[model samples]
Target: MNEYQPQEQLQNATLILILGILSIIGCFCYGVLGIILAIVALILAQKATKTYAQNPEMYLGYQNVKIGKILAIIGLVISVIYMCLVIWLIVTFGMEALQDQELMQQRLEEMMGQ
Candidate 1:
């Protein structure tokens, strides 16, 4: 039996990598975009990973998938942490913290005092 091989690339590999990079950068935007993009990238990468595993010789972009997965995970973790911080701030300081400087100062003083 004879097999064919060529210097080519895998499908969705570049996309996954791009999405992962974007997600990491976008994490600064309150992490909403980052989280969304990271999740999408990760889902796509999983599919690509399965495909690659099935035929390792068929793809040339597994590096993209691997790096993308790692970046996506990091982005997701950062986003989750940012989200949690937002939620904690809202819960601990209340919505007034965003609107009232006096209230914020009072809350800060109260916390410091305690």
Candidate 2:
């Protein structure tokens, strides 16, 4: 008779999930924080995947890793787009214009020939 061993939860699965969620929310913060969090989650997910592949039956929570990786990818894309937009704004409108909403609006109107 063979004794059964309990399966362990994959390491970093929960952390990855939390980071994935946070990365999306962090996108509003200039996209830097979101990018950081998403990168970390992706790295951890990759590690978890390798671990799971080595012994599929020895660990659980692979689903969380998958979900986290998907979410992280989404967050990363969104964050990159947002960052690009911010950089474009800074480049199109001088930094001083960005400091003042009224100035920024005025510049936009001028550009629009309003």
* Top candidate, metric TM-score: 2
Tell me the tens digit of each residue's lDDT in model 1 across 12-109: 99999999999898888878989999999999999998988887987799999999999999999998888788778888999888579999999989
For model 1, the stretches where C-alpha displacement exceeds 4 angstroms are 99-102
lDDT of the structure predicted as candidate 1: 0.90
- The TM-scores, one per candidate, come to 0.86, 0.94
Residues 21-60, candidate 2: write the lDDT tens digits: 9999998888998999999999999999999999999999
Q: Candidate 2: which stretches are off by over 4 Å?
A: 1-3
User: Could you tell me how far off, in angstroms, the CA of residue 64 lies in candidate 2 after the best superposition?
Assistant: 0.7
Q: Write down the RMSD of all candidates, one decimal each.
A: 1.9, 1.4
State residue 98's C-alpha deviation in candidate 1, in Å: 3.1
Candidate no. 2 TM-score: 0.94
